[model samples]
Target chain A: AQSVAQPEDQVNVAEGNPLTVKCTYSVSGNPYLFWYVQYPNRGLQFLLKYITGDNLVKGSYGFEAEFNKSQTSFHLKKPSALVSDSALYFCAAEPRTGANNLFFGTGTRLTVIP
Target chain B: SAVISQKPSRDICQRGTSLTIQCQVDSQVTMMFWYRQQPGQSLTLIATANQGSEATYESGFVIDKFPISRPNLTFSTLTVSNMSPEDSSIYLCSGAGGPSYEQYFGPGTRLTVT
Candidate 1:
């Protein structure tokens, strides 16, 4: 079975400060990881994904995530968070060798303080 | 990446009623999926709507409760039947490519059952 774990329920970051939302996963082999954002009363927006190759991957809205294979973690990061970045973040894991099954973590709420 | 859209951005209905949410994709897709998200939880896969077959529902989800239709390669609909307060949540539609392997999500439909 494949699953993802997000240790934090909420993360608070000051505007212009760096932000990190932690995520980890348990899958059989190399996993395809993804990050998504959701605003209140809205649907999820794709943030980024890590399939292979580079350890660090950059994505939309100046967001990036580091895929650490040894740690089984892919933590989302941003050098400078904005108030607009405050939203719910979700991490997902998909088996690269499967028929496209994506298992998502229980979301993390991000609050960028002014 | 493909653009996805969902209809009935939101709807409020009394108990025992049913509501159908429509999803449209700008480009042709092979795999279209439906998901459900509770107030603060991550998304759960509801069903996989193939272009010309019965939807493959996940555990604890049934076709009777959530009927799905995939009339073609770019359009799908999901109907939540016999709604109750527990059914109140955000419904999202996603389309993923076979070769590019990127998943695109729709804005989602917010359903409130009273």
Candidate 2:
């Protein structure tokens, strides 16, 4: 089976501080992980993804995530949080199963305060 | 990667009514997917749209309730049938050029069934 888990339902951070949204995955084959953001009334935007490369992958909007094979984790991280970054974040994993479908985690709502 | 767009960015419909959402990809893509995100919840994939075949639905989703169409490589549609308040949420469309586990999303259609 393939699944994604987001540990936190909400993450609160002060603007300018560091932020991290945790994610872990379990799959039969190698994992392909991705992060996406959704604003209040907008569609999800692709933040980044990890296929096969360096442990750390940088993505849009000054965000990056580190893929840990041993831990089975790919967590989203931002060096400095912004109020604008406050939104719903989701982690997804794609296992090369029957249809190569994306399995999404329960979202994390990040609230960045100024 | 491809740019995607959905029609009627947001709409409010009455119970028992149906809403058709259009998904357009800027470039040719081999696969397109429809997803549903309920309020304060993570995304759940509804179906996968292939260019010239029937949509492959995920568990708990059915073609009668959520029919999909993919006339070509760049255009598709997903219709929400007999909607209810529980159906109020964000509907997103995503596309991928190939099966690389890297998907790009559209702006999303916000549907509110009253």
Candidate 3:
């Protein structure tokens, strides 16, 4: 079984300050990890993914996530947070081989204070 | 990445009614999936919509409650049957395949069962 865990239910960051949403994975093997953002009354928007090479993965909306294998973590980060960045964030993972359906985390609500 | 679109962006239905949400992809995709998100919660995978075959449902989901159809590679539908207040949620459709392994999600259909 594969799963992802988001330790924080909510994260607050001031605008122009750095933000981080933590996530950890428990998979049998190397997993494909993903980040998604959802605003109120809207669907999820793909942020970034970590598949194979490069521990640092850059994604849309000036966001990035570092894939730390030793820590079994993929933490989403932004150098400067914006009020527009406030949304619900989800971390997901799937086995690299079979069953491409992603197992999602419980989600973390990010609030960027203006 | 494929562009995905969904119909009936939001709707309100009475108990015991059924709602069918449509999903269309701009390009061909190997995989399509249905997911549900309750208010202030994370996403949960409903099933994998296989093109030309029955959908593979996740552990707490059943085919009778959420029948899915993928007649081709570019389109799919998920029908929420016999709805109640507990059925109120945002239903999302996603597709994966193309050059990227990451999945693209539609804007989603918000269903409110009264």
Candidate 4:
């Protein structure tokens, strides 16, 4: 079955420091990878995606993800972290050739210490 | 990208009662999906609804239990039938279209069954 994994269940970073949320995928073929963030008591917000272009994909809210095919990883990253950036992050992937169904990871909760 | 909205952002229902959540997209989309997120868990796709066709349900989900209606391109509804405490979750709707392969989600409907 196709799936994505977030090794870390929770990540803590000091404000103004760089933050990284790791993700890796296991799929049959080239897959479409995406990142989403959900705030408490709110819905999900699309962060970014890597379809078929540059490996490094930029997305909303100053968030970006590096798609490494060799390692089968698409890690979400930010140059600097803010208290507002603390949320639950999810990594998802879909097979490029089949239906547009997405498989999501178990999510990582990021906390930015002020 | 298309903007999506869902009605009844949160609801509390008694066991054995049902709730219908509506998802509306600002623009037409090719595919719309229904997903369930249990507390502190990842998303699990319930079904995929396309305009002019019966919804394709994923494994472990049956049409009779969770009926879906895709009346048009811009709107869809998911009805959770005979709800139970186990059905208490956040039901999310997502639309996949546009040039990018990424999907956009609505503010989700939180269902609490007691």
DockQ, in order, for the candidates? 0.57, 0.63, 0.60, 0.65
Give every prediction's interface RMSD: 2.0, 1.8, 2.4, 2.0
Per-residue lDDT of candidate 2, residues A6-40 (tens digit): 99999999999999999999876876789989887
| TM-score evaluated only on chain B, model 1 | 0.96
State each candidate's clash count. Answer: 0, 0, 0, 0
Structure candidate 2, residue pairs in collision: none
For residues A3-91, what per-residue lDDT tens digits would candidate 3 score against the true structure? 79999999999999999999999986888899999887777889999988999999999999999999999999999999999999999
Q: Per-residue CA lDDT of candidate 4, range A1-114, in tens? A: 788999999999999999999999998787889899999987788899898879999999889999999999999999999999999999998887659999899999999999
Output the number of the lDDT-best candidate.
4
Better of 2 and 3 by TM-score: 3
* Residue-wise C-alpha lDDT for candidate 2, range B1-114, written one tens digit per residue: 688999989999999999999999999988899998877788889999988899999989999999999999999999999998988988999998665557888888889988
Candidate 2 docking band: medium
Better of 1 and 4 by DockQ: 4
Give the per-residue lDDT digits (tens) of candidate 1, residues A1-114.
678999999899999999999999998788789998888877778899998899999999999999999999999999999999999999988886645658899999999999
Would you list the clashing residue pairs of candidate 1?
Answer: none
Model 4 / residue A87 / CA error / Å: 0.6
Sorted into a CAPRI-style docking class, model 3 comes out as: medium
Ranking by lDDT: 4, 3, 1, 2
